[model samples]
Target: MTLEEYKKEFTEDDAVGWLEIDKEFDRLYPDQEPKHYAPPISYMLGGEYPLDGVSIYESKKQTDHFHFVTYGFSELYYNEEKVNGEFSKWGFELTFRLKPFEGDNGNPPSWAVALLQNIAKYVFSSGNWFEEFHFMPANGPIRLETDTDITALVFVNDPEIPKKQTPHGEVTFLQITGITSAEYESIKDNPGTAEELVNKLRENNPLLITDLNRK
Candidate 1:
């Protein structure tokens, strides 16, 4: 859209960018109400967490799994001055695909929300951004207090969601996929091999869903 049109539409609408994100999800899941988790008070008003919210959606694309998407990583509010920039705040948001475990009962677990928030806290504090093939050790089981061996994470572009252009800027969805302890060791020292590892992972798991029970 033209800059003049953008100003006319979003001059006073603070949720211009937010609505764009919702539009994408709405197209993919019409009439679906995602399970949303947000801080009691917003971070702008001194909430402990940096992320504004995370939404969990039920998916059965390749298998039954929960799709978690994060808000607040980018410029979710309207700012007239930043309209000409090449990218929004960070130019990207975080996403995750998680397979349901035995006790999930068709609902996303609280630990998953906490995990996303913790990652957001790191980005907000450290000014670091995640990219495809980048990996991190979760220090222990990704699901805390669980016996699962999925102890690491690696990033890739989400297969289903493509980058979008909003009046604010461009946004990319970076999917965070979990990895096992052995998989972590294989790529920790050799970051260049991360892509290769992901390819190997996809041989059996096409969607690269994070399965906590899998060894």
Candidate 2:
């Protein structure tokens, strides 16, 4: 979207951005009450981090993977000046579909939230943004105490939803898909190998849940 377009959008309503994002998610999920967390203070005003809050939703029917979404990244608060750019803040918020490991409680581990917060810190402090087909290493196994083999992550557009344009800018739902250490190295060795990775993943799993045990 152009700068002028974004300006006019906010001029019309000034809330069509983040409000639309919330409405979209609510429409998709219906009336499910997901576990929610919000910092007492916003990072923009000197709190913990950039994301104002995060929601963790566990499917009662499925009970395997958790859906995580961040609120602070995409114009969570009204700021006409900040939303004037091409990308609203970081352009997108992060989402993760994670599996509950063995011996885990119904609640997701605290580490997952910390990981997401750290990523937000990186973007807010570094001024870098993420996009689809962008993959990065978590340095080690994503689950620190777990004996999981998955050590990397790749970014892709969330399969269930498409990108949306907000008054702030365009907000895309960026899902974090875990990859094996070997697969991570392979991508680093050859940058354009994501196509092959996607094809291999599509052989059995479609949602691409982060399977720590996947070989």
- Residues 1-215 of candidate 2 have per-residue lDDT tens digits of 45576565556444555576667668767887778777778775889766777888764333368878887778765565665456666778788888786646656766778878888888888887888878888988887867777888888887776787665667888988889888899999997987679668856766666766776
Residue pairs clashing in model 1 are: none
Model 2 alpha-carbon miss at residue 157, Å: 0.4
TM-score of candidate 2 relative to the true fold: 0.85
- Off by more than 4 A, model 1: none
Across 1-215, the per-residue lDDT of candidate 1 in tens digits comes to 66787778776756877787888788878888999999999999999888889999888788988988899887888788768567878888888989998766766887888998899888889999888899998999988888998999999988788988878788888889999999899898788999999999899888788999998
Model 2, C-alpha of 2: deviation from truth (Å): 12
- On the 0 to 100 scale, the lDDT of residue 137 in model 1 is 88
Question: Candidate 1, TM-score vs. the true structure?
Answer: 0.95
